[model samples]
Target: MEIELSLPEPDPAEQDREVIETLINDSKYTSFAAKYLREHKSEIDQLIKMKTKFGNTWKDVVKTGLRVPNSKVGFYATDADCYDVFGDPLKYVVHSHNMRDADPNAIPQRVVGGDQLSLQVSDACKERIISARCRFARNLTNYVFPTSISPKDRVAAEAELKAALDKLTGDLAGTYTKMGDLSQEEQDKMVENHQLFHNKDEFLVKGDFYDDWPNGRGQFHNNDGTVMVWVGEEDHIRCMSLEKGSDISSCYNKATKMLEHLDKHVGLAHHKDFGWLTSCPTNVGTGMRASVHISLPRIKANMPISELKDICKKNNLDIRGTGGENTGFAGVVFDVSNRRRFDVALSRCHY
Candidate 1:
């Protein structure tokens, strides 16, 4: 039975020509900005194309593996500068739904094939790596610029660039460290999880499995030999089978672990004031609290709309309508309690 899924239609009216114009204007300011944005736009277009491919690849991978509801995996750029450049930093907060959620029979078709999906993931990973490299290069740019160009302005720019590079480096290093430290037992556990829906024949026949799965065989099969060919293990090409909440917890865990490692490696004296010789007062001890992205659709519907405004004031949550003044549709920003202390104990307790 063929099913036609109803997809959300794009709103032409919602497109912000002004923001695009502003970005074009902003790009003209610095040679770096102009060159970087040109490359960024190209990368973004490639990312969209890759996403289309990866979406299909992931579906095929799941079909050959285990099926789990709420399984999702997508790349998110976490840097502040990228967020600003993209025009909506908070949009990353929304979770992406899988094809199965949208359409159960959404199998690997010509356009949405496994190869495309893998390519998409590769492209996204590449984009992230490129973004980091660009940030690092920006620091070099600042250093290359002469000290004769106003010490105060140069110093401020240098500090900003350094902070951006440091955060990116720390995050990348932390992820690698966590992955490298994973025990053999832990790796086995992941395999075991995959084996839950394992079919010996299919799992073992591993020659370009993604592109050629079920080729002209014309049907999916199960381990028990049921004619229900749509019964093979769910393919998880991107490891979306894992729980998202758990993923967030894992990220928090890694951050704390890295901080602990840094504390030990650099020693207290070295990082007494977070290694900043002239530290920003705002980030002195524990920096800003964790910020959460929340959808306030109801607030938008009822606004100028003082009722929600009162609530926001009482709760200390910042509310912006539609697009934040600068960028539309970015949603509201809600601050999570607890500043940057990286309370390992609290994180553990929550876990």
Candidate 2:
């Protein structure tokens, strides 16, 4: 049929007026709400009064199931669909986007992507301009009232604020553009790889041996040059034996004896800096727990699960869920036990 369909062009001036109006109204309403809250003094009672006074205002601004702008992904604003425009118009207007199929590379991407697109500014340059305008307006409102400002004064301040805000918003947008964004996953990985240890000072471990090799002395130096020493070979060996515990009781005994010897020989001043070296809430009653990284793939699929549980129990090892409860996702648990010793220094011999 040789017929073409086209959307009508929006009036630029009219749209600009609408955006200016929205920003101004938002500022005014917010100021009014703030003043009301101040007057009420009691937040709970004030909130109840506000809800009653502006119940219909909420309905006009918000729509059901509509996500508010700038609220972040996977989360919604409280009472998002409710209007209460006087309360926080900035929240409502900031999220309002009008652009269909907004480009990711668009100028002022933050503003255009969601509810921000509804502003009167140009598609190419408006987002930043509007953001600047909004910021300036809010700042001016705060400046005028300091305490007792009227809603009309706040609205009047928008034009002056818009100019300043636009400039600042543009500068900010440019900065953001220069710093290319990384995906959330990449950011998480970077955070996870950050260094865990911060202490660089030396620490001492001391203990007395009770067995044939009593009076054994050992010292461990960390990469940071921190040193810890324990007196007595049996105490040192008992500490090392934490990983080879036949039962929890045996592990506890060795850990306790090691600590006692350390206290007697070196004293708390020497090794107290090391968190693991001291008796804390988690390891207080049990000392340090040794954990072994095990590969679960070695276990046969057809083997009876009950036998595995019994074997673990006999070995004095606690069975733990890797991914899901009872169902083994990984072939083995990272075998962890407390009642054993960790060789702090390779050069130091255990009792």
Candidate 3:
């Protein structure tokens, strides 16, 4: 049975085949992967086209479309992963997590524990992992979405949140002040606390968030700097708290308590079925984004961006830059956060 039959030479074009093709065509796929291939046919086509024409971003595909509820398939790839894979001279991966939910129908919601894990950033920063921050947002009942709201309404909503800060005076122990008033050192201090957001989110900009400027915008942090509240950032009220180490118990306690106190005092807008409603449909549920900042010196020195990203995705985490959303790296600081928000109980997110 050791017969040697002459075979045709391999085609040069097929020699370096795309990984996507292997994923789609391989019969050795497990039931999960096989079902994945069948369900994401259109996305697969897009990936193949990218591979054949421009370049393929396996990290983006996996991170945005992996194991989680309401997986964001067709997620636009960011150049950040490309930079990470190429080992950008200026930055390295960091780990952070976020818990968020949105109530709406435009974006498809996934079943319990569906595709939503991307792990490159978290793995790179595992050894250097520092701490986790948990946060959430709530919009007011009267005001329309920030995108559609007039300048007058924006100010009104901002004023409302500013008033709510007082309700937290004793329990949370923080002062409310404008960002511009904070000096350079103070601003830098806030940055480390994950309490400072200098610019507006891009989605907000396209929706005309700058119409009223920072007139009503302000930040609040507790004495020890573990708690924070953003008035007039992207949402009407965004409460956040970040701890110094990966102590989920402590971090979650501060975050939930902050929300609990604020909700009791100033009532977060909510719908019966949808839970918390945010400006972005993506953040309608728990509206919590829990993340940790980590440093990855060795991974920065050893791997290519693509392979590094691949490792992270395999591990079920996501890597976003310090400045956030494609503003380039922040040296070695990265935000690694939980990607699943729907299907799972909000309480379970801490686990």
Clashes per candidate (backbone, < 3 Å): 18, 38, 42
Off by over 4 Å in 3: 1-127, 169-171, 179-194, 314-316, 329-333
Candidate 1 TM-score versus the reference: 0.24
Candidate 3 least-lDDT 10 residues: 88-97
After TM-score superposition, the amount by which residue 236's alpha carbon in candidate 2 deviates from its true location, in angstroms, is: 22
Question: Ten consecutive residues with minimal summed lDDT in candidate 1?
Answer: 130-139
Q: How high is each candidate's TM-score?
A: 0.24, 0.20, 0.58
Best by TM-score: 3
lDDT ranking, best first: 3, 2, 1
In model 2, the Cα lDDT at residue 253 comes to 36
Give per-residue CA lDDT, model 1, range 1-351, as digits (tens): 999999888642232222223333553333222223334554433222221111221112122112211212211211122222332211221111111111212221211011210112244333222110000000121121120123343334334432332443333321111222345576356346432122233322321222322221111112231111111112110111111221233333333333333233322111221211101111212221222234444555666545655665455433333221223344443222222221122222111
Question: In model 1, what lDDT does residue 33 have?
Answer: 22
Residue 256 of model 1, lDDT score: 36
Predicted candidate 3 versus true structure: per-residue lDDT over 1-351, tens digit per residue: 799999999753343234445544755533232345555666554433333112434432332223222332212222222222322110111001122232344222212123233224345444677776777776666555454456776777666766667666655777888766778788678767556765544444544544566566678888788788887666777777776766645666666666666666556665533456564434545666777777766666776656866766555455677655565655666676665443334545433
lDDT of 2 by residue, 183-283 (tens): 44543453343211111111111110121211111222122311122211111111322222123233233333333443333232111111122111112
Error of 2 at 167 (Å): 53
* Best-first order by TM-score: 3, 1, 2
- Which of the predicted structures, 2 or 3, would earn the higher lDDT when compared with the native? 3
Model 3 lDDT, full chain set: 0.53
Candidate 2 positional error at 317, Å: 1.6
